[model samples]
Structure formats: C-alpha cells, structure tokens
Target: MAMMPRMELRQGQSLVMTPQLLQAIKLLQLSHLELQNFVEGELERNPLLERDDAADVPPHANGGDGPLAADADSFARAESLNSQDGMETRLGTALDNVFQGEQPTVARLDTHGADSLPVIGGAYGGSGGSFEEGPEGFESSLTAEASLHDHLGAQLDLAITDLAERIIGQHLIDAVDDSGYLGEPVGEIAERLGITSARVERVLAVIQGFDPSGVAARDVCECLSIQLRDRNRFDPAMQALVSNLHLVAKRDFAALKRICGVDDEDIADMVAEIRRLDPKPGRAFGGSTAETVVPDVFIRAAPDGSWLVDLNPDTLPRVLINQTYHARVSRAARNDVEKAFIAECLQTANWLTRSLEQRARTILKVASEIVRQQDGFFAHGVEHLRPLNLKTVADAIGMHESTVSRVTSNKYLTCSRGVFEMKYFFSAAIAATGYGEAHSAEAVRFRIKQMIDDEKPAEVLSDDAIVSKLKDGGIDIARRTVAKYRESLRIPSSMERRREKVAMAAGGR
Candidate 1:
C-alpha cells in the first residue's frame, strides 16, 4: 500500500457529547449546595437567567395552585376542624379511620400512637410553602466565632506585661495549631527569636497555663500533663498512664496496671479523669463551622406499607430563561458581534434551565428506584438491606452504570430511619449457603454488630464463632471476611473486647 493524501467520506455513528450534555452530566453529580453555588454563578454571568420566585407568589395571584395556596387551604381546614365541639375526640376517630384504609397516604405516628396530620405539599405533592421561604433570620445575623489565634491574643495581652515577653508570647501563640498543640519546638522558637531556650520555655509554660489549659503543649501527652498539672492531680501514677498512651489505646489494662503501679480501680479512675480533659482545646474556639447535609431526596413510609420517594423541592434549583429580555436585547443589537452575544446568552440560559430540570427528574427517578429495590430495608432495618450495586440500579432504570454512579454521588435521602447518602443503598453481594439467596455486605456487617452487641462478657464471640453463626443463618461468609467487616466497623478484636469487659467489671466493683 502506498501512502497518499486522499479525502475519503465514510458514514459512521458516534455519540457526540455537546457542551449542554456535558453541563447536564456535571450538574447531575453535584450536591444541592454545590448545584446552588453553580447556579448562583450562572445567574450573575448570564443576562437572560433569573431565579424562579414563582414559589413565593400567592396561588390566587398566579391563578394556579401553588405552595402558598395549598398551605392556606390546609390551615383553613385545620381551623374549621378545630372549631367543632368534641374536635379532639373526632380528630382521633378520623385518624383511626384513615389508618384502616387500603390507600397509602403520607402519615406519621406521634409518641401517643395517634396519627399525625399529613404534610400538605411542596416536595411530596400538592401546593405548600417551601422550606427555602422567609429570611435566614437571627442565624445569618450572628457573627463568626473568635479564632484560636484571636482568643489566645486576648488572653496574652491580659497575662503578659513586659514588651519582650509579650512578643515571645505572641510568637508562641502563632506557633500553636488548631488542635491546641504547639507546632514549633522550643529550641526552634528560641533560635528564630534570638532568645534563650530557657526563656522561651518559661513563656510557653505561662501561656500553657492560660485559658484552654493545654493550648500551647507540644504533643497529646504533654497536653494532658499540662491539664493535669493545672488540676494539681499530676501524681506519679497518673503521670505513668499519660506517658504510656499507646498501651491505653490497645486496651491493655493489665499492662497499664503494671506500668502505673496502681490497682485496677485507681487506673480506671485515672483513665476516666484523662477522658474528662479536653483533647482538642483549640477546636472549641476557632474551628470551621460544620456544613449541614441537606438531602436531595426524601423516602417516607406510605400508609399502605410502600415507600414513597420525593425530590426535595427546596434543594431543586428553580431557574427560568428571561425570553422577553432576550428578545428585546436581540432586537436592539446593531452589529453581528452584539447579536452573537445576545444569542449565546439566551442559548446558555436555556441549557441551564433544562439541565436543572433534567437533573431533578433524574435524581427523583434514581431515588425512587432505590426505594423500590431496598423496600425491605426501609420497612425493617439494615439487616434487611438487599444486596445491590450500581449495575443493578442502572439496569432496572434503563441507564448506564456510570450515569447511575454519578446520580448517586454526593446525593442524600432523608427517611424515617435517618438521612443516608444515596450510595449507602448499594453494597457488594455476599454469597449464601446451599441454595439460599445472596446477602448484602452491609446486612452481614449489621448482623455481626448485633451478635457482638448481644454477647455477654462471659461469652465473647470470636471471628470463627461469628462465621459459624452467620453460616447457620444461611450467609456463606469467611472468618477473614467477618474480621474485615469487624475492623471496618471500628470494633476491637475478641481479646481486646474481653479485656475491656473485664476492666469495666473490675472498675464497677
């Protein structure tokens, strides 16, 4: 064959990933907060995109059944019901009647066993007020907490008098980490400041004695020692225990007893006292605020024993393209450059709105299928969680495994049991004995935890024993697999557990 410059036209098929399609895929995997941020950025950048405030508009004004209207209807009905004589008795009777019906409606039970009124709309169904409505209120107005550095600076200003000593103290405070451990060595600080090591040590000692007792200590053991010295309880036995934290971590109570030169009761007392001390003193002062996990989907038990899945409307980004604005701008454009800019903005805005809508629908579809597949889990508990995987869900919903994986990522579902990440429903399958059905790895882990929790101090279950118990229950799992699961659950080995139980018994006595 000779190499030649030639143009050959061939017909073929390929899936082209357009920019809009890529954007949709990217939006699918983002958590609610991330999606909100992305949308907010788009709103600022694009001229034709605006937030959908239709939710806040009254239903009567919009001439549609919106959230506000539904909420008003529900409140009206509640008031009317309340106005009747013997309303409390009638309400209880009405609930009883509703509970006996075959149709499933969203209902909850109070501590008194009476059926709580169903929530009317927004995420589940109908028109109702959204959780996103109203001002952020007092929480938004509250100031950020003082950082660890600021807190220490305030204390340092009050405690130190001399200029040279105050400068050293501030430098030492700067070296202290968020965990309240001194990051720099005394020799290093001394060398850096052209000061004597002894002077640095003295200043550090005074600063350590400042509020948050152990703020300037070098290590965990030193931190504990500082707190103990402040309490005037740094006795020899307690000192020994603090020095040998590795043994404490291993639950080697017998070794602790020997090292501390104390009886079981005294060692236990010292351990308890150490536990009462603040380990991360600086965390209480200036750690970053924990971000709340807002679930994208909700799973509720219907009255008919089926799980009802709904997308959180509050989490769903509501965006609309300003078609009127786009039309007006396009008409005002005099040149191709101006016309192109207007058209591009309109296209981008349209894609974003469609992407958001598709993202919500896909999330709802995936979540609903998950609830259907793991119906046993929601009905019962973790023990009943079916063996599931991304492929299983993908195949069931007629989507690719990668698409399913992306949908599940960073998304959470709120249910009666608790809020769990969407990925939690999918676990590797564990084989079963004989001709029995496969078990979920998660369900197996739950079983092992239950067996260990129920085990008496006198009868601690080993890995082999757990394997035997699971085998008897029709789950064909290995001892090593059980051990892996046990370790993953942060459970100690049988020996460690037995030692802890024995220590607890001795301490109680």
Candidate 2:
C-alpha cells in the first residue's frame, strides 16, 4: 500500500507567487530612495507610468485640441494637487472612487511641518510630517561640481585631438577611485584595454593637469608630485620626500633629513609643507557624489526644544498608472489575446500601487520604532544613542530580524547633527548597571566625546585613562575596547594627540 502510485483526482489549492507577485514582494522591501529610483526606471520603461512632474512643466506646453494639460497641472499642483501629469492628460486613476475622488494636489513637502503629510517608509518614525525648507535668510545649494570624470570630459573636449584619445581618457579617469588613486598600473590597464602604456600615460598626464591637479596618478606620492611639479615647486628636496613616502609615514624624520640632505629643522618644515598638499587633489573639485544618499528620515528642532521626526518627502516616490493610456490600450486591442495582455498589464499596475502603499506602511512602522527607541537622541544628542539591536527594533516593530536588517541597511536618518546611516544608530550592547539592561554604545560614544571635550588639552587622555573614567561613571569597558571605539570615532592615539596639541600651542605662541 505504501508503494502504490497515487491516482487521487481530488482538487487542492495553494498560494503560488506569480512573476508579478514576486516583483511586488521585492518592491515592498526597498527603502524610500530605492523605491524612488525603481519607480523612475519603470516610468522610463513603461509608457503607462510616470512621476508627478507637474511641478516642473508649464501649462499649454502639451497644445491644441489636446492642449498640453501640463500647464494646468502645474497650476493645480501649485494649488496643492501634487500630480504626475496634467489634469486633462489624466493618468489612469483607478476611478469611480477615493484616490480619484480626492485627487491629490501637488503638495510640496512642508519645510515647516504642515497639517497633513504624505506617508513615507518605516525608515522614518511617527505620524509627523517633514518640514525641510531652508529658514528665512537661508539659501540651500550644494557647492560640489559634477565630478572628476565630468571635469575630465569637459577638458578632453577642449584638449584632445582624436576621439579615441578622449574615449581612452574617460576610462582612465573612471579608473581613478574616490581616493584619487589609479590603483591599476598603467601597463595593466593598457593590456586590459588593448592600448599602449605610452598612450595611457599621455592621456593620464592630460587628466592630471585638470583642475584638481594630480588626479590620475597611480600612487599617493606620484599624485602629490603631479601637483607639486605642476606648481613648479617640486624641487630636488621635495621630490626625494615624495618618492620616499614609506619612510615619511614610518615617522623616520632622520631618514627624511638624510635623504633631502637637510637638517632636522628643514625636514620638519618641509614635512609640514608637504602635509598642506592635497593627497586626493581630484576630490578638491566635486566628483559625481553619486555615492551621496538622501536620508530617509529627518528630525528637526522645534522652538519648544522638542525634536520632530519625519520622512523625507523626496524619498517617497509619487507614481500613477496611466489610466487613460490603459483605456486606450484596451480600446485599441485587436483580439482576445491582446485584451488579455492589456488586462495583465492592468493587474501589474494595480499590484505596483498596492506594493507602494505597503512599502510606505513598513517604512513608517520602522521609523516610528527608531524614534521611540532613540527619543533620548532627539532630545539630548548622540550621547543618548541607546545600544539597540535588530531584535529590539524587530520586537518593537512586530517584524522579523531579517526585515529590520533590510530596513536599516543603506537607509539614512537626518538630524540636527547630520545625516547618518540608520545602521549607525544601532550599536552593540555595552555593560552598564552592574548586570542589568546594557547601555547603548551610542550613549557610550557620546560619553566618550563629552569626556574628551571636558579634558584639559595640556594632557591628552590615553585609552586606558578613558576606560578608567568610564568605569567611574558606571560603565564597565576594557581599555583596549575603548581604544577600538576611539579609533572608530577617528580619534588619534595619545602620541598623535600630543603632536597636534604641541602644533596648536606653537602656532598660538
């Protein structure tokens, strides 16, 4: 009986994830910025989808009998009808109800926290609205230029004779990373790109001459020398120091002195001058800043001294399915198959909308938990950063650990201090209160910052010394651990601290 083949004809049912459903589920977990980018990409690929670009377009731009509805959309959006396209060229609003009935006005994110706010991701906490407008007399502008690549392109256009050279130049420029070092050797690049080493060097030489000098160098010393040579200040002595960078880093002042054939005093002065040189000169001029991230959440100080937490409106993508287009697509359908295809498209459109709403709910939920757990941070500052883990947030948000990890990773929170990754707020639990609930690493970092700030500059505290102070304040931490934390905070060692202090003292005197 156990070996008999099954011949049952009984019907069974189970939920199977369709391709569309899978896509929807995947979309649900994306953070605010990712969701925005996803929607933008879809708008480009799908003719039936678009962002609410009404604010940017002028009325009467579309024209004639079907006169551009763009202008009217802009006016309407100005009146708070935040919309995707024009009113006349209406995107398919799933009609006969609510979203259509309440047709959204182009509501600008309230920089001053307006009455009602659109919902964003769980990356932002609370039901509050974000108020991000620069205050009176405040002008907002990012001074950073396009990038090293773009700058090189502009220069190449003016400098290069052949198109091939320009193409080769761009690849080389791109090869240079954020650190301004072309880590790949010119010969290796030549072999990989099927170009000659001499050609690569020539192109790189041109790139190095671009505004942020020394941009295309293969090494840090070479990068600095490129700048120095360009300025015509790279004398024999300076050249020796730049080339023997290893010795300089080893703090071998004597070796540097001997190499330059100068006294210790001259070496010290030369080293100081070299320190003033930009190691990553290319970055002195703005790069793509493509790595720039907009914080998913924003917290601002209220006049009453309370902090209001809200999501960045820009992060929440405003997407609408082209209802009118869908209708036309249906009308234009020639056969049953075509109609079915259109119907499927309609289904996907609806699923996208639902997924977006679900994303918003998840983001809001996560953000709310963060705000609750880190309330002390909003009120006090970084010192109040509680040592919270994914489990702590997951429990508070009623989600799984995996879900919390997704929400926190690559997400940002904007506060009065600065924009920080959400993950930055989550720290390992530190021992406090003898054996009770642990103190937040954030709290300890803040304490560390405070301790350093309060200490007299004449004597820099060592890591061991700092640990002793923390223990006295009821925090039980090891000396080496303090050193590790201090290092992470970019605090230098005791010797470096003394050097800086001495430098400052000499300058003041």
Candidate 3:
C-alpha cells in the first residue's frame, strides 16, 4: 500500500531524564569519598548551599541560627514527600516540575583485598624506619625516597671519573629494576650502546657494590652471591647453595643439604641466614602507603534484638540550604536573568539537599534488608550468609532491581562481623541434596577457606578431599567448585600449600 504524508496527532507519556533526576540517580551510586567530593563541588557553585554545622554545636547552645536552618526544613519536606503513597514517583515528579524551565548552565567542575605476601621489613633506615623526635615534634618521612636509579646514579657520579664509563654506568643502572636485578643482559645492553660487553660487565660489577649490595645483578643467584660476598660469607658451600636457589624455594631441604655439602644443623643455619637477605633490595627505596577504605553504613544490634542501620556520621556530608540568602537574592533580583539565576540556584540547592537525605535513607533501607535477609550472618558468621540476589531485596523493599543494585555498588556496611561491601551479602545459590536449604556461594567459600586454614600441613586437603568434606556438611558442590572457591579466597593450591608448609617446618628445625 502507498502511504501519503498527512498531519496527525497522538497522545503519549514517557519518562524524561531531567538534570535533577539524573543527579539523584548518580548520587545513589557514588561511594562515600566520591559523594563527599560531589557535594563539596555543589557547595562551591551554589551560593544557596552550605554545610549544616549545627550537629557539631554543643547541646546547651545547639540551636541553629540564620539560613542554615533551611536544611532541616528541606529534610522535613523530604520526609513529607517520602510519606506519600508513591514516594519515589512523586519525588521524581516534583523534581521534574522544579527544573522544567531551567536552562542548563555550564558549570566548570574540575574533575582490593589482595592476599599479599607479608611485606618483609626493610633494611635499617629504609621504608620501615621509625620516626624520631626532631628539634620540632616527631618528624615524618613524607618525602619520596630516592629511587633505585637515583641512588645508583649518585654512586656512579661519585665513583666513576671517566665520562664515557659514567655514561655506560648510567645506562647499566637504567637496566636495573626496582627489585635490584638487571632486566637486560650486559651483552644486549653493550650491543645497544655500541660498547664492549666486558666494559659493561666491569661497570655493572662496580654498580652492584653500591649501598643496596645487589642492585645490578642479572639473576637471583648472582644477587644473593653479591650480598654474601660483601659480608665475607660467600664460601664454596654457600656458592653451591646460591647456585641451586630453586631447590631452596621448593623447600627440598634434603636436596639443598646435599648440594651445599653441609649437615642438617649447618644447612638449617644457612637457610635461616638466607631468609634474612633482601630478595627485592630496591623495593625498600620508594613505595606508597596503601589507601584505606571507610565504610558508608554502620549496622549495630538494637536493644530490641534487631539490626539497627545508620549512616556513618563521619562519612555522611552535612549540607544545609541558605534560605535567608536565597530569599534575599530573590527579593533583590532586578531582571529576568538575575531572577532565573536565583531560582535555578534555589532549586538546585534544595534538590541536592533532599537528594543527599534520600541517598542516606536508600543506603539504610538496602542495608536493613540485607541485615534482615542475612540476619544469621550478623548473629553467627559468614557460614550463615543466605543466598541473596538484587531482585529479592528489590521485591522486599518495593524498589526496582537497578535501584537496589546501585545502592549496593561501591557501598560498604560495617557490623559485628567487620566491614564488608554491600555486594558481599548477595551470593549465588549453591545447591544442596535432600530436604535442606541451598547455601550461599560466599558462605561455601568461607567454609572452604576455614577447612584449608585448619588443615594440617602433613594432611593438606586436595580439591577432591575438600569436595568430600563439603558434601558431608550438606553442600552439594563439585571438586572444581571447591577449587574455584579456594582460588577466589587467595588460598594456594594443595601442592603449593604443601611446599609452604615444608618450608615452615624446615625453618623451625
């Protein structure tokens, strides 16, 4: 059929993404630090917004004065709106209406639990040095320490007099890595620099004699031998032991003892001495401190025998609306442009205040539901964490799945068990045989970890053995599933655990 163009009218409704609505959605997903930065930016741009410092005032004189009180009023409005039949729907509608005629203004805004090996303490006066009281109070070593390259460069400049040799020495030093081992071979470096391999080796040997003692060695054996020679301990037996370092790493104490030609007592003493040597000599030079996580919500047990969910007051950014200033600006506005500016600021300020309050409430709500569903987890431990999903929480709280997901993303809740990501409560179901309830995958992982943690070195549990134990506990998980969970918890394989245990046992000897 041929169609002709004609004028027609149709009526329909759709959800529009207003700026305020988008802001609210964005606010819900931000972590505590991120939300703090966003609110600080808003406070800088909007003259009507200020932080509510009333909570900080002493009780006797806690009464707030001036426009800061508007925050409480905004909170009241939020509560009243929240009490409506369809609170979220009504809240969105009100925000949309307020920002309806607002023209967008250009605002210039300037923008892992890893099971790490225990960091061995650095050598004397290295990264792990203790602070001493200076002429002032205790002085901190905040300044970045000299890098490996810088340290070697200084030594090269002082020790080498010839310009050409100094250049080669610098190139050789550049080849050294943070672990104090040469990344490139001396011959390769010589070829690249159009120099003799013997000259490069001579310079590298000198550089290895620097303060770190093993900074320019090409391999672990050479690195350890350099340190040992410097300390007058690199005897023939020590040389043989250094050459067969891999056997030492595998904890083959018998093999090591034979190769070093030492009895059990002497080899044990040698092994203990080797443990004191720095494997990554340059690592002590420059490293940053780890960033710590601050939990967003705090869950404590109430006197009524239930979980009490509250926003961490320390993390929650206190904000207020300067109504007195806003009213004054509105009265003094001389033209449409000025009035619009004031109106936009007021709306933005009010929306942000309400949105912040709503963000807190949503976090509390989601945390409460989580605590309710996994109340056993809070009461007991991780083993009792039930199988949970976003849809289950959304259904219980009468919210969308995506909203629940946002509330849990990048947010953490702290309880008696310790701080955990909100996502920690949501785990896939692990099937159970017979008439028993399914187990949370997380709980299963924790159980697997517990088994591994308790396993004696002599009787380290293999994946198959772990599967049998889990089945005995009523969790119908496969051997592969046990292996997967074990890896996820950063637990090494049974073979690796056995090696580690062997090493510990040998060290004790």
lDDT of 3 at 276: 88
TM-score against native, each model: 0.76, 0.69, 0.66
Tens digits of per-residue lDDT, candidate 3, 26-132, equal: 88899877876786777778898876653432123223332112222343454455456223211366333322332211111110111112222221111123335
Task: List the candidate 3 regions with Cα displacement exceeding 4 Å.
Answer: 3-8, 54-91, 94-249, 252-273, 280-291, 499-509
Best by lDDT: 1
For candidate 1, lDDT tens digit of each residue in 194-261? 66899889999889988888888888999999899989999998999999998897778789999989
lDDT of 1 at 163: 52
Backbone clashes in each candidate structure, one number apiece? 1, 27, 0
Q: Alpha-carbon error at 298 in model 2, in Å?
A: 4.5
Q: Which lDDT values do the candidates have, in the order given?
A: 0.77, 0.66, 0.74
| Between candidates 2 and 3, the lDDT winner | 3
lDDT of 2 by residue, 327-418 (tens): 88889999999988777667666666655655555555566567667777766777767788889988765677776787676778777778
Residue 21 Cα positional deviation in candidate 1, in Å, after optimal superposition: 2.7
Per-model root-mean-square deviation over C-alphas: 16.8, 13.2, 18.1
